[model samples]
Target: MEAWIRLSIFVAVLALMLVWEAKRPKRSGRVNRWHRWRSHLGLIVTSSVLMRLVVPLGLTGIALWASEHDWGAFNQFELPLWLAVMVSMIALDLVLYWQHRLFHRVPWLWRLHRVHHADPDFDVTTGVRFHPIEMILSLAIKAATILILGVPATAVLIFEIILNACSLFNHGNVQLPTKLEAGVRKVLITQELHRIHHSSVKRETNSNYGFSVVWWDWLFGSYTDQSRAGSDNVDIGLREFREEQRNTPFWTLLLLPFKDK
Candidate 1:
């Protein structure tokens, strides 16, 4: 049931973003949409399969197990269910925000992370384009977080759904109206901010790492208000990965971390 809920929401958001980008793109297309989508979708599918096989119980399952064994902070003490859920979600988001920063600051991790950044375009599909090993590592981190926090299964479900939706929404090629974007981004990381994160420029790429909330970047001082080249003209993807054929293939992404350049 939890798997079905997550899957249904993921498909719905993905389809909506695809249609939104088709009708109202923020930037002109840079690469063949079909080619990029094929590779991006392939990565997500492969990652999902590997995740299921590696951790069949999933995060919610881990949370449930922790609760059963009274194995985490929340379980050891008493808190209102609502408070527990809210605190758990916030804590999980905070840890993930730091996790994202760690990936960029650490060299070996960046090798794994660059696969997501190596996309030659910024679009909804790019949101899901991550190396499978990175995905596994990410799951491990979240599981460890769950074990430590005793996060409620409900909170885990809600956070996972929200995180997936936010990724699709912010990575979208379609932009909100200027006024709307300004207002929305005060709380959420809108496409305007996320596009800067995908910029080929090193400084811009390193900033705006938050996927869901805008606060983490602001608090961490990694927030870049505008792209140096201007948001409309921001160069997406890694500067070194200009060759689409080399960067967009599944095999290439799988082996990218091992390559020097």
Candidate 2:
């Protein structure tokens, strides 16, 4: 059921991206690089498979291992079902907020994260452009959180759905009406909010690290509004690694962090 929902959402998002790309004004000097499209497709398909299938299988093993262990911490806290789920979501966001910040602030960690930033264009596909190593590390953190918090699998599933949906929504190049954007920003992170985070400027990229909720950034003092012109004017991608890397295959991208540039 969840798999169908994810696939439907992915298709909807891809359709929206195609429409937006078609409507967007063409730049005279900037030629469309059609070859990169294959790499982008490869990235999205690979990540979708990993997140929707491979990670879940691995997580089942981790859950089984955790069940056999005497992890008293998982049972330490007791709360109402609603409260427990809420707290678990917030805790996950908090961890993600810091993890994202660290990816920008720490040079070594940035190498793994750079795969995401290396995209020449920003779109829905770019949202899933994370290195596989980074995804594994992220999964490990999530597994640890589940073990420590004893969060329900249902809560994890709900949160994952919301996270993926919002990620695709925000990463797509859809321009919202001012009134709509204002309303959405009050509750969810909109594309305007996330685009600033993808700015070429390190400082901008370091802010707005929250995935689903905007409040994490607000609470952590990393939130930045894109109302200002300069906030959205910056370029994207790392200056040092700006050369096109579309030639790099899936295996190479998987092993990127370990390889010398």
Candidate 3:
């Protein structure tokens, strides 16, 4: 049932984002969407298979188990259910912000993390383009956090849905009204801010690490108002992988971390 709910929301939001990007793209490209989707979907499938084989129940299962065993921080409280859910969502996001920062700062980790940044374009599919190892590590980290925080299982479901949806939405190529982008970004991460993170420029790539929300970047001083080259002109993808084929092959991404540039 939980899996169904997550899957439903994931599909719904993905469809919505895809449609919005098609209708109101920030940048029109001649790139083949089907080809990019094939590669991106392949990567996602690999990671999903890995999770099913190893951690069949996923993070939500871990949260449920932890709750039953009375594990984590919020378990000690008899607070109202609504308060617990809201507080846990914020706390989890805070940890995720720092986790994202670690992925950039740690050299070995960046090797896996760069698979995401290597994408030559910024689009909705780019949102799901993570290396399998990164996804595995993320699962482990999230499980540990859930157990430690003793977050309610319901909150876990809500957070996962929101995180998934926001990732797709932010990574999308959809254009937004200038004033709305300004206001929405003060709370949620806007696509404009996310494209800057995908910039080929080293400094910009290191900034705007938050995929779920923008507050962490603003609070941590990693927030850059606009790309130095301007959003429209900024180059995307890693400088080292100038050859577009480097990012297209599933085998290349699978072995990217171990390969010599």
State the displacement of the C-alpha of residue 187, model 3, in Å, after optimal TM-score superposition: 0.8
Worst 10 residues of 1 by lDDT: 241-250
Residues 20-68, model 2: lDDT tens digits: 7557612111214454456666766776567656566444345445445
lDDT values for all models: 0.91, 0.68, 0.86
Span of 10 residues, lowest total lDDT, candidate 2: 25-34
Question: TM-score of model 2 relative to the true fold?
Answer: 0.80
User: What pairs collide in candidate 1?
Assistant: none
Across residues 39-87, which tens digit of lDDT does each residue of candidate 3 receive? Answer: 8889988998998787888778988898898898788888788998999
**Candidates ranked by TM-score:** 1, 3, 2
Query: What C-alpha RMSD separates each model from the true structure?
Result: 1.0, 3.7, 1.4
- TM-score winner between candidates 2 and 3: 3
Model 3 TM-score relative to the real fold:
0.96
Better of 1 and 2 by lDDT: 1
Model 3 pairs in collision: 73-149
Candidate 2: stretches off by over 4 Å: 1-5, 16-34, 47-78, 227-232, 245-261
Whole-model lDDT, model 1: 0.91
